[model samples]
Target: MVSIGTAEIISTHDAYHSSNWPALKPSEKKEMEKRRRIGSKPPTCEKKCYGCEPCEAIQVPTISSRPHLSHYSNYKPEGWRCHCAP
Candidate 1:
């Protein structure tokens, strides 16, 4: 069993990630990894709302119908900078 940050990650099987879906594709794995990394960053209280501009512009995309990327969004935290850069 390995500890990530304050969370205790249990071994899903004899090996790490053994519980991961068998059909998970390479692209999905990479995206999951990227998100996992981002969730660990410290909050940016001073930065302006992403406003669909993406903080890093490396991943987050601009979607017309999607919810705005701001502290008030339902899925993200306030003061949390957008994953994608401007």
Candidate 2:
């Protein structure tokens, strides 16, 4: 069986000006703005794995400090486990 895993930036920290907000797409920027207006703190990032049976799992990394999104852009899921079923 073949399993495919994908990683995506779900939301960024509230430290907008200090992060890579300027480099984000227009749509992403809009979403962030909306979240901020609603006083919601978005996760740093998200990851998921998909198998033949459509199994789903979510993993969130821990951020020791408020780093730039640029750092997250290069994040590596070294020890992540996929819960996809065969």
Model 1 agreement with the true structure over 1-82: per-residue lDDT tens digits: 8888999867645465565658668999898778877554545533444364444412233443545545466464323233
lDDT of 1 at 48: 48
Q: Would you list the C-alpha lDDT of every candidate in the order shown? A: 0.53, 0.50
**Ten-residue stretch with the least lDDT total in model 1:** 55-64
- Per-residue error (Å), model 2, residue 47: 27
TM-scores vs. true structure, each candidate: 0.27, 0.21
lDDT of 2 by residue, 1-86 (tens): 23347644433344445565358898988996787674224332334442245444435455545565547577543323345545
Stretches > 4 Å off in candidate 1: 1-17, 38-86
TM-score of 2: 0.21
Candidate RMSDs in Å, in order, are: 13.5, 20.0
Where does model 2 exceed 4 Å of error? 1-22, 39-86
Cα deviation in Å at residue 16, candidate 1? 5.8
lDDT of 1 at 21: 50
Error at 76, model 2, angstroms: 44
Name every residue pair that clashes in candidate 1.
54-84, 54-85, 55-84, 55-85, 55-86, 56-84, 56-85, 57-84, 57-85
